[model samples]
Target chain A: MDLVLIQLLNGVQYGLLIFLAASGLTLVFGIMGVINLSHGSFYMLGAYGALTLTQFTGDIFLSLALGVPLAFVFGFIIEWLFIRHLYDRDHLQQVLLTFALILIFNEAQKILWGSYPHSVPVPGYLQGGIKISQFLSYPYYRVAVAAFCVALALAMMFVIQKTRIGRIIRAGESNREMVEALGIDSRLLFRFVFASGAALAATAGIVAAPLESVYPGIGEPVLIISFVVVVIGGIGSIKGAFVGAILIGVADALGKVYFPAFSSSVVYALMAAVLIARPGGLFGRAA
Target chain B: MHNKSRITRRDALKMAGVGAAAAAFPFARPAISQGAPLRVGLLLPYSGTFAALGDGITNAMDLYVKQQGGKLAGRTIEWVKVDDESAPPKATELTSKLVQGEKVDVLIGTVHSGVAMAMAKIAREAGIPTLIPNAGANVLTRAQCAKNIFRTSFGNSQPGVATGIAMIKAGIKTAVTYSWGYAAGEESVAGFKESFVAGGGKIIKELTLPFPNVEFQAGLAEIASLKPQAVYSFYAGGGALKYMQDYAAAGLKSSIQLWGPGFLTDGVEKAAGAAGEGVKTALHYVESLDNAENKKFRADYNAAFKRFPDVYAVQGWDTTQLLDVGLKAVGGDIKKQDDLYKAMRAAKFNSPRGPFRLSAAQNPIHNFYLRELKGGENVYLGVAAADVSDPTTGCNLA
Candidate 1:
């Protein structure tokens, strides 16, 4: 029973972290109608940024504070220079352009950081485990990360469902022409959405950096998993992503413990089952 | 003027005849001259995850050549390099290009075991003399052993067996085994189980997850509940760092002893920080091995590379040393296959890792040291198994 409870927590923590990465991809695909294959690269940039900034600031939180805005600006520039041109193109063209960006970002990371794996230090305060029982103690840093992700999810929900910008964002997602026809600058709104999405993924990377090793190609795995989450949750539904992420995470955790041999295929199996049942996704609109 | 400048059929026929003769003349001479350069193809990863390892091996090999005044066994060396990208699917094509296309007389490679397996199969079929610097797949020197192929690195199971023996000697009778679900992991655990069981130890459980996956929460929780006396695991590079961190973070580090092959702490110790300390492991080489050859190699490597040499560099250096011994015995006549293989198989030299020689299966027979991680370094504790030799299972050498 204790094992099951702990595994559930593990699944939830993992799911929330991945939700941060997948939400950005779904938003870009949903709102801008652009398949940004390089969404994972933004996550990589955040981790590397945290690695560099923490070395200078001597604190992980301070590094997070500085890295998010820098990532926002970087994403804004990337959209203006490359992604904006991709909006009007076909999915194949968008995929090609974004895939090329993935390759470019991977090589650039190698040139800048070399191939050695690095780790960001958890701050002194968040360095130990919180005892749950006689045999179970969860790391304080992991608990803190889970709480932060929950807070971010709530804040995001409030903005997208309750604010003026949120309304315009949803309006653009449903019909870009109608949003533009209402005298709103859809292009500028899109730029903001893409940048904010980039920042969200980066924020995940920064917080998760201390939890795992930061290395070249670290983002590729996260990217692949996030795509699965997006597809399972319906491409543009943040609520769906949340539900999908937690489901996959919990399923993956339990599967690994009980079915060690086929653990790697568990998430894919869940996705296949979901797709077979729903055709679209649990929250995805019919095509 | 245009008609005069254009090539006539007669002129083209004459040029074709000349080209045919030029190509055929080389085949007429059966043997290469003694002083001619020997073509050595280096099929190793120059990009991807193992690039740093590839560079280390290449640099050390080049350093040895430079030390020998840019020649070996009275012949200048010609190097041909192809980046394998550490992708196994591309290995056969790359090996063929090096052997059939470039006609390299010798082959050296590879950091990834999967790529090395493919390269070895091709090199064995082609009957090319191949040296493996880093990959430690046991099959290379066990079930699939070939006369033309030699491995300078230890087998994947050697360190695990050493660790098992060390743990039994330390009086730990109950333990669990954990590793990535791959051939290397399985083989290492098999080795550990063999030794541990022989020494009257009982295994509590065997846990595994997918290769290269760092999510260890579920696995760690299980370990905490089961409460084994010790845990033996196999991981390297980034995965190793994360495993150590997770183990320490779960509060199991104080109650359960963690053991693994030395790769558990080898290259990622600094990044692992406090989580890596006090972990015991067994390996064929440590930076602090106290020996005359090791001391000299360390000084020379530091002087040349401007950084401290790791186990990969030591393996690379030994590879060249073995090659030098073979070439000197054959007087640089690479075509003397019988004599060259005999000399290479009989090679005995003092390596930086200690006295090195080949087992009957042509894998390295050397000491496995028991070491503990202290302050981001593998502090040598003692010899876990001296001059350990692999069992050479299923190797007929036919």
Candidate 2:
């Protein structure tokens, strides 16, 4: 039973990490209404940027401070030059354009950093073990990461629930035509939201870089999992992204902890079960 | 008396001429060097998920081809390569193209063990020779063992056995392994488990990480709960990098030592970094090996590539070297499969990975030494040898 408790905690921790990754991906799709397949590419860039910045500054917090803004700036440039034009295009076209961006990002990353995984070390302050109990102990970094995720989740709720920007985002999600009919430009709002979403992805990437590897094709797996999150969460729902991310995370983590031989397959099983029980996700708006 | 002396000298010269003629005649050019640039089909992973890893191996082989003057023994070594994508069906298709379309003389390469097994069948069916660089799972030599197939790689079990024996000798008591679900990983784990158990060590936990989706957090957590003395794994390439970093973050670095099948060479150092510090694994070649032949190969290879040769590059270099030695043994008389096979089995070639002979199963019997990454290069500690037999590998390799 203690082992089960430990695994549940492990699952929650894993879920938190997945939520950090999937939240930004959900916003890019939900607010923008254009499928950004390369959202994970932004995450990868953020990780790479964090790696470089941390190495240069020798401070992980300062590195993140530097990377988050750079990610927004990169998103701005990419949006203005490449992604903005594809807004009115079909879903297939959007997928193709974003897929093309994936190749560009992968190659550009290789050309800039060479074909190797850059090791991102965890900050020295967060580098020791913490005692969970007399018999069990866990890494403080992981627990701190979980706390960080909760803080981010609270911050996200504040930004989207109580702010003027949140009102505009809600207007945009409900009815795009109606949002434009209010005499306020949705395009400018979308561009900013999209850019902010990119920053969120970068934030996750920076936080996870020291934990996971930063390498070529690194963005692709995350991108696919993000898609799974969006579908399961019901597109255009931030609350659903959180719930879906946690569900997937817990299912995946527990599956591996208890039944490692069937780890990958477990996520799909949960998705299947969710589809049967709740077709529109836990907090999704009804059509 | 002078005329008699001159006649004897002429007779001796005549004999010398006859001997020189016989010696040079086989290696001597016949208006054209190399026999029709014997087509060597490369069944490789050029266009797939494994493309990135395959790219390095393919680049090394092509580098060897160019360095050998675009020819092997005066014959152009034309590469008729197909991107297997590490898929079995695709590999079989490409082999058909190589056999029928390209009419290759010998087959080489194949990163995936399954792909290698398929190509082995092609070689057997077509009466051609196949030289594998690193697909060392035992199955290639066991159930599906063919006549003309030869491997230059240390068998799959060699690395695991080497690591297991070294850890056992090092006085480790408890160990846990994070192995992927594949023949390569499974075979290595099997070898490690056997040796580790026999050497009076206990396996506290054995975790298998599935392929395609490798989120290692849960596995790391489970293993941490077990509280083993040491941890070993067979995760390679990018996956290995993630495992190492996460392993470090999971707070196992200071408490539990990391064990691997020696994927800690220059190839993986980029992915692993400081977390892989003090990591011990087994391999036939370490960058720190000091020998006249290895020194020459290193200098020459570095001068050409501007970097130290990794295991993949070494494998490519050794493959060509073995081919050259076999050709020389048969005096480049590679008109028939039997001749090439016989010469290869002799194992008279000097390899970069020290001296070892080939088993009748066509796998190399070699020393698998424990090496560590120190100061950005592989440091060979001492002699670590494991005498592996030609046990029947149950690969269903095809």
Reference-based TM-score, model 2: 0.85
Clashes of 2: 5
TM-score of each: 0.91, 0.85
Q: Could you give candidate 1's per-residue lDDT for residues B98-136 as a string of tens digits?
A: 999988999998877888999999999999999999888
lDDT by residue for model 2 (B1-398), tens: 23323433553475476467647876553444346556677777643234445545555666666777877666666566666766776777788888888777778867777777777777778867788887876777776677677887766777888888888888899998888877778888888898899999999878888753457767776776788888878876667777776776666777778887776334767457677777777778787777776787778766654555677667777777778767666666577556777777876555667776787777777767778766556678876665555465553322
Residue-wise C-alpha lDDT for candidate 2, range A61-166, written one tens digit per residue: 7888888888888888888887788888888998999899987787566555544456777778877666553324576777877898889988888888999988
Residue pairs with colliding backbones in model 2 are B33-B74, B34-B74, B34-B75, B37-B76, B142-B393
lDDT value, candidate 2, whole model: 0.73
TM-score of chain A of 2: 0.94
Q: What is the lDDT of residue A59 in candidate 2?
A: 73
Candidates, DockQ = 0.30, 0.19
Report, for every candidate in turn, its global Cα lDDT versus the true structure. Answer: 0.86, 0.73
